[model samples]
Target: MNHQERTHAVLSASGAHRWLLCTPSARLEEQFPDTTSDAAREGTLAHELAEMKLRHYFQTKEFGKRKYNAEVKKLKTEELWQDEMDGYTEIYKDYIKTLALSFPAEPYSAIEKRVDFSQYVPDGFGTADCILLSGNTLHVIDLKYGKGVPVSAEENPQMMLYALGAYQAYSFLYDIRSIHLVIIQPRLDSISEWECPLGELLEFAEYVKDRAKLAINGEGEFCPGEKQCRFCRAKAQCRARAEENVKLAFNPDKGKLPPLISNKEMGKYLAYGEDVAKWLSDLKEHALKECLAGREVPGWKAVEGRGSRDWTDMDAAFEVLKEKGIAEEILYEKKALTLAQVEKTIGKKDFAEMVGGMVVKNPGKPTLVKESDKREAITNKITAEKAFQEEQ
Candidate 1:
């Protein structure tokens, strides 16, 4: 009925596969706020791009189009879906070229193998990104494009889950001696890789399964911190998080204080348990606005009023020059002086002091400045000059 609700519905319907692939639970929507914001749109776009690149790679291979067409037929028949697929393919192609140049034969972009993690499923289901085969070694690369910090490839729950899924799905086809989890965050200047024995990965998978079970069963504790709460969409609804925000907003003694000898000493000494930072910030903003409006503060003096400057009266200067027997053309021409030239004429120290705190003001109300004003001023001056010439 409302904008947010409608947005959530559209996102949910369109991003069901993405949600399932990444978080695999309704609770993920509660946990990660960044995952729900406009930033999530970028992630969706990245995923679509990655998929398109993969499809294009397949198309280039023999019978790739037939295989892709068959898969598309199996998936859905929506025009919107097809358009998205095409868009993703183009994005992926560009992304892959960049990756290739950067990594150089490091097998950038998509890995087209599926993984099963049925044994590691603690509560709900989970899936891996894709499994990579490099010579005899097996590597798993996960792409994380969101602003959220990339999950460390080493000892990461998400990476471990993906490893489990990969091993489950692909072990039958390969010798599968070892598993390496690599997290690539192109947005961040980071690439982390971790290796584990086949046995170790399986053990970690089991550990993750236990954790997932606890989380699903409502036994998991909230990890409350600034970093965790930054993009959490469910923050307003979360009791623990709401309390944290209230404490942060109201806690006077919590933040860093300046040296106690100044006004800061009074602030710390009178540490009312409530946060006064917001009030102080608001007061400063209001004070600034009043000062700009030329309103006088009780204890503050108007040290200087602002005004504008203009060129000297050119006609008066020209008349003085003419009386001094100088040519009108030589005297009335425009000229610009450098700082050094000005300093020679007026001593540097005096000039510096004179100009140090100069404040320029608007000439007048902007509305008074019109084309007609200039014309009228010039016309009146011309009329007076003609009458004076007649008298002469």
Candidate 2:
């Protein structure tokens, strides 16, 4: 796996949108350490694999080095490697190859390139996965290994910042007129793109400059919202976030529900419901951690739960079961895994090739959801049914 290097800047492009929204958070976050989760590790592994494939295909000898080979060997053994990862990286690599040849002149291509935006933001720098620079345009492509959330390219600050940084790195030699940002999310079968003129890009740079100044000086308000607090390290303790979540209930008393819940009220809940659920889970995790570390919480305590028994020797256990004349039905239970899980294991394309005709989806049931959700909502009532008249 390509190990995630510790970030040096207080504000990198990855968190620019968040810090831009809550400037003080940039300062506050410095007090805490970086926390790498399993998902992040998986993402790094996926990127490493993608980079390796590109290096090989592009005929770069760097991937043949001992360092790269050792990391690749280590990463491939981990559980994150899947058949689907191959398909995702192929899509990303193929796009980069196509984008390189799309323009009139042969565009210069760089993989896993470091970009600096320190001119606009204090110590601002990031590593863009793939950058293609041509005469009057540049194509910046990013691979998102995540499947839960589909990343969009429309007005995306991270991509915009990457473009700005790339422009800073290459504009002296190339007269760039337009910038293109592409987000490739193969897991979700999505490739979103956006383009902007050089004028608009400069305008955004001005906005980023102002925000960066405030963020560096540690002099901005803590206005909590869903996007800002989604990844904040101090989210649980932030008063603004707590207040926003508390506003969801007129009264959270156990005895009775809120007196009113019209469509307007329901709208607020739907919008903020995911954030509230995340807060609850975060609070529980925090309390459990504290208790495990010898700190006491007011109303909660951790206790061991009932666990199933296991045999010391599987062969002996099987022999004993046979000796007892136990039926196979009692000895084992059978259940099939879902297609989604199998697809992820085998890769999306291969899963279809292997089991395309074997599966069918049932019509979905109606459910209330945010407008942002990809799926269309099914209405509860079908209005104005036509009545049939008897034919002559």
What's the lDDT of the predicted structure labeled candidate 1?
0.51
True-vs-predicted CA distance for residue 110, candidate 1, Å: 7.7
TM-score of each candidate structure, all chains considered together: 0.44, 0.85
Q: Give the TM-score of candidate 1.
A: 0.44
lDDT of 2 by residue, 1-392 (tens): 24477355788888987998899898887776678878888788789888877776564565566755675677679887765667788888888787776778766878788889989999998888888887788888899988887888888988888888999999998899999999998778889999989899999999999999999988889877778888888887677777777775343435656787878867766776768777777778877888899899998898888999988998789779988997767877898878788888777788889998898988877766668776766665553442233231
Tens digits of per-residue lDDT for model 1, 1-392:
01122233211312323222233233645454433445654454555455544555634574376765665464345332333334334433445455445543554223533344546554233333445554434667666665555546776655666666666666676677787777666556356788888888777666655655544444556654433433335433455544654565565455675645575555443442222343344345545656778887676543455989875896887788799998877765688996646644665446668873553444543342223232233222457668899999
Minimum summed lDDT over a 10-residue window in model 1 is located at 1-10
